[model samples]
Target: MSEPSRIAALVVAAGRGARAGAGDPKQYRLVGGESVLGRVLALLGAHEAIDRILVVTHPDDGDFYARTTTALAPAAREKLLAPVQGAATRQGSVAAGLARLADGAAPEIVLVHDAARPFLTPDLVSRAIAAAQAHGAAIPGISVVDTIKRVDETGRVVETPPRATLRAVQTPQAFRFAPLAEAHRTAVAAGRDDFTDDGALMEWAGHPVVVFAGEAGNVKLTHPQDFAATGGPETRMITRLATGFDVHAFTVGDHVWLGGVRIPHTRGVLAHSDGDVVLHALTDALLGALAEGDIGTHFPPSDPQWKSASSDRFLAFAAERVRARGGIIDLLDATILAEAPKVGPHREAMREAIARAADIPVSRVSIKATTTEKLGFTGRGEGIAAQAAATIRLPEEDA
Candidate 1:
């Protein structure tokens, strides 16, 4: 039997994204705690149908790409081909990626995607691939909800198109590899690189294109405000809050771990994990928000896998569970009640470490310290106590 046809994904991420304003190109910027490109790559890598993945980047962005991809899972990293340098225009950049794919064993079907669209789900990918396999060329599109007007040079509305017949196109456009490659080469030979998208180029080459249903949630990040508008923690419609508390008694050690940071102290806490009181409290706060059980329930002391495990791992797992449920960690506030190894000295470091572990920004994490007036166990320096509150936002489902 002939080998099964292979499918590949080509991500075009060379644009400077000047309209997004300031900092790295929008693709490298963080959205929901992960870079836009990294999220796209992770989604594509997690899809079972996509055989290989290629990225096209700007020449000066190699270092930025490396740094941004550091958060990707090992399996995702394994699927990526070394990124190739792109040209000035988006069309040229896509063509460059196509050439690289052709240099090796070319895939039978190619899915062209935009790095800016970080929310591309696996179902959308499968739909596009299936459409392309059946129709030879396919693109995803959503019905236009608003009326569209065609205007002339004088800013006059020439005609109002029927909104029912209109559709807003999106990327991850799929096509048969051989014809798409030939179409790109023909366009380049004829100096016709101004076509807006690959589907248009294919149309100009007399190829038929089909449209599949596009996901409304798969929005592309363009302007700076777009980041805040797309269900980000700052603007989510549904909000939840939960509180947690933890205490670890002092032992005969020289240091203590709090919020993933190590502090020099005269004594330490006895526990199965690293005994980070702050992180433990924060993890439970997150789990509480999700209506899930506490850290002990997820990682029982009886389980050898959790023996001496770092508390940061527990917090990271909780954060991921929130994301998996289509939620964002909006805010995290913690207060440490301790009399020794002053938390003031490492406040910023603790916030940073917690933010890193939770995959959120430091601005969203708050750390504070208090002394209990030497009236209790914490005041006597016998142990450290931490209290935390977590705010999370999840999509509301209809009852």
Candidate 2:
């Protein structure tokens, strides 16, 4: 069988969504428990025909976007490209996306979509792909149910146009990549960002654009009430919990590192790295929660670059790994077993240090200290040990 045509989806999410003023951009607002843009990107990225997913976002929205993407599934996360900054105008943003694609390996077909329209179905996506292949350029549109009018500047009635001749347009607007890119480039050169949509831009460029079936349920969420009607979508989520334990023997030194802070002690710990026992245990716990290998698996003892490296780096790396996989680290709890250095003196410091490394609030971190009562390695003043647990949430399908 011949290979299917390669397709890419360009999501325009730079709009401030001022009309739907609940707070933040409407795209970043939660529809269900997930951000509107997150839902849109997830649906598009999960589609088989969409080989690549590029998003155009406002430059200031980077942090918001990062937080939102943690709700996606792994499959969708894998198809996403690094998002690019969008321009002031929606037309300018589309131009930016086209330009970005043109600089690299472009796809045969590209679909332009609005981030506010979060209920896009896989069937609509598939139909759009087929329509673009058949018609070179096509937009999904539904017939206008109400009578339309051509209005004058005054409130008086002007002309009633036939409803049959008018259609309400929606997005996932598909087109042949090369021609659409050319039209967008021409529009940019003429400094004409007045065209509201790509269809109008194509029409201006003399390209024949066709209309495909559009769903009424795929309504563009504009006003605040529109959000009220949407309690939330049925996006599934699952929580994961994992535990880790680590031990390190003491050697000759003046101090030791525990959690992410250095505490004055009678001796140092022996390891390839700085040997922060508490941090190593917490790092392992986070990786274990994601079913990813332990800290040694990532920063091998054999690797020369990691020699005497700070354990905080390992914890930060593990936390970022969870974020990249579309997961949220709910909490990190650690218990330190040491006899010599009293942990009570620096408990809050350790919590603050660990929280900084994990990019979470200090409230999410708990550090408890206990001694073995002169029994084992930790109690005999021979070494220090720690145990940690990590709780996280990920898309249920991925879990």
Quick one: best TM-score, which candidate?
A: 1
Candidate 1, poorest ten consecutive residues by summed lDDT: 229-238
- What tens digits encode model 2's per-residue C-alpha lDDT throughout 69-146? 754655676678888889989898998898887666788999999999998899999999999999999999999988
Each prediction's RMSD over C-alphas, in Å, is: 9.1, 11.6
Q: Give the true-structure RMSD of model 2.
A: 11.6
Clashes of 1: 0
User: TM-scores of the models, in the given order?
Assistant: 0.64, 0.60
Write the residue-wise lDDT of candidate 1 on 1-399 in tens digits: 545439999999999999988788889887665678988997887688887899999988888899766556545666788998888888899999999988868889999999999999999999999999999999999998888999999999999999988889999999999999999999999999898788889999999999899999888899989987864434424689999999989999999998899999888899888999999999999999999999989999999988889999999999999988877788999999988889988999999899878877577899998999998888887889999999987766400
Over 4 Å off, model 1: 1-5, 231-291, 294-320, 325-399
Full-model lDDT for every candidate: 0.88, 0.87
